[model samples]
Target: MLVSKYFKLNRSQATLDFLDIHIDKDIPVFVDPTSLRSLKTEWGHHCVSLLQNYFSCVLSAIRKGDDERAKTLLSCLNERNEFHLGYSKKKSRGHALGPASADEIWKSLSKSKAATTGLLTDLEDAVLFVDGVGPDMLSDAVCNIIRGPLIEYTQNACLYYEIPMEKEVSSGPVWNAHLERWEQSLIELPLARGAPIILIPKVVVRAKQSYNSNEYYRHYLMPVLQKHHKDTNSSLVHVLKGKKNKGEKRVYKTDLYELYGADKLASAKLTVAHPSALTNYRDAKKSTQAPPLDHTALAKLENIPNPDFPALLNEATKLRPGSKDAYLYEDAIEKFISGFLYPSLSFPVKQDGIHDGRKRIDITYVNSAKSGFFEWLSRHYAASHIFVECKNYGKEVGNPEVDQLAGRFSPSRGQVGILIARSVADKNLLLQRCKDTAADGRGFIIFLDDIDLRELIGQRYDVISGDSNHLLYKRFKALIS
Candidate 1:
């Protein structure tokens, strides 16, 4: 009665489905709070403390007419400028007042009472005195320095911290940009760019009303204060609340303990725990050990054939010339891989290219197999992830196609990839190019054609019977080698 059936889930869809379930169920994800806290302390609080201390010393030296000591302190500030705080506009370069410009600013500051002035005011004056510079640039730099660590800290909090929700978690953006945007928008306000923003999820704060407010406070805000209380002891806690005017927002100020109070601050504690962390937490926690993957289950998946393979292939071939259904081909290839190969693979994340936005990889697999031919290949190539590119063109894939997949390979992203095409007319030539790339240490590329795909799919009956000799994986290994 059923006309046809297709492979059910692709790597990308599977990952999203998993995340959706996890979030919807309100599963607790954990992060290494200690390491994250240390990083925050170093970058967010300690960095600011050192800057303020150096600035105070510089001011003291200048006031006593000790130019040499003042210059020395100024030099210390210049040295710290190496870790500039602006966005990377061109590769690694950012808009920061370099050592030379910093010296110029310090020289001007020393000539006036600006050295003794408020930190933000002094920095603003220096920026104004410098030619061809603006507050935006300086603000970006300062905020980047302070907020950079906080961003990482906030990410950890969001990943691990649990908030009780009555309804299913909304399918929204992974990160609640409310805090990030609020902190960034502060630069445009009367506050300094280096102002610290405590990242408390709106959900957690709102949930405080449902239960004991102290529980929420002890769980969320206490760790932050314990790590950073010294540096920000006298600093006010700034919370961004409702809009002030059209396209503008207001920051509500409060004391450190006023929001939750210091009653249970000391007793509030968090420890590293499992099943309360992001999926990636396991990868981080066990750097040496590969995350567990059900090899038996994945192997069993190959036994199931998509009855609609013939129909799907026919439909693929009949696709109109220059049809926008290129994505259809992508989906087909993804399905083929899932059914014919491993089922534990992770993604072609919704965002085309998870790493580089400019380029989009057709398919990506986080080699999740523990022990198998694919796992062996992963270990051989030292790749934790594998990239696949599918081209449904009526003609043979060329050098440019090979180059595209090769370009995506990197040590971090696994220096191996696969190219799936309708056919490669000049098979020998294409293989030669792949060999050249491998010889050049660029990456290893395995080319798969329509016939190869069908062969793999056709063997499902044998695989299901446990009689097939894993010819698909063997052939792939031979081709790559």
Candidate 2:
């Protein structure tokens, strides 16, 4: 069963910030390090830093000929089955890189031309030159290195959804960027069928890694070989008969492939000779965008449907204000935002305490917007975090509620918030009060009533088809204007 279904969270994969992984089997996805470097969010940058530090340590150990330390470092990268990712055929029995394999990899790196020439920078680069190290192994190693951040993300997701977790679970080997080594911690984690599972963010996971040996061989290596064959007039070139022209020549790409098979060592040798090819490849990968998986793609992967916003909204509206079930409204809003504004906002935390744990925001999300209004907010208002306050009040929301959300904002945490209320007796009154908060230099607060939320939900289909009129953009403009 999927994690959401198992926990009865009443959520679909589309509405979740983290992947709703199967409890017993593995999913065919990977955490691409190149994708991590492509992210614009603070969280992404932090993860990239961790990756850099860990790999730097490995490189240093190999360079200094510290065989014992290098072996110890690589040994920490056991298959991380808890993530329920990779190509595990049936049940997720983790495939460990045993002592012998570790030694093999260590020796390969030690004697590697790519490593000696500074071409192997990140773990993903190992796929290009190192024998037997494929995307799955590199991804597993990355998972071990950044396990700390993943653990924190999982814990926060659990807290947001009220998922049950076991206390004092071993955190596995997490990379310590400061100490330049791996460390384990005892912390709370959600367990499935008596085994602990780590939640991976949907934004970070990919159907295939951006960095691939095949891609390097084809796009980078083959092109260089093509130029070489053309310059040398090698046998791989073909002279073709044209309709008008007397002579025309072309190269049989397939013949070139047959001549030089897709071998990593051969490609590495070519790269070493024409180092610019490697530089160009790195630049191209850096420039290419690695967009987060959309709702449809995520749904298809998990074999689930995208969220039914209208039905979800109806369920939330049915709950009575000030009742025991009133919290469901907050949960519903979180689901709605996560479903719609993903890749813009992610990793939502519930009851996020600030001011030394004295004040609690209802929901907080990392402002990970690559485009649209949230991106604008990040550029202009310093919205590193998106604060939300859910008020399930039966009547109109006034100054106090607006003040509460605005109070949660700061230059550091972000200066924008959204106040979600059941209904507003006077929409203009709430808007004016929110304006007053902005005018006072406290923060920007946008008020959304149930009716307005319903309007947003009603536009779901249009938005999904890429015909969005940018409703949130209009709402923010209305607030500031």
Best by lDDT: 2
Total clashing pairs for each candidate: 5, 0
lDDT of 2 by residue, 1-481 (tens): 9999899987788678888899999888888897787666677888899988888888889888898999998888776578888889799865445566788888888877787677778878888888878877777777778888889888878987789999998888888889888788899999888899999888888888777788888888788777887788888777777777546656666876777666777677668887877787888888875777777777787788766777767766878886576677888778777776677788888888888999999889887766666767778886998898888888878877887898888888789888888887788888888888888889988787778888877665443343437566566677677
- Taken over the whole model, the C-alpha lDDT of each candidate is 0.43, 0.80
In model 1, what are the clashing residue pairs, if there are any? 28-276, 29-276, 29-277, 30-276, 30-277
Residue 207 CA displacement from its true place in model 1, Å: 34
Model 2: how far residue 256 lies from native, Å: 4.8
lDDT of 1: 0.43
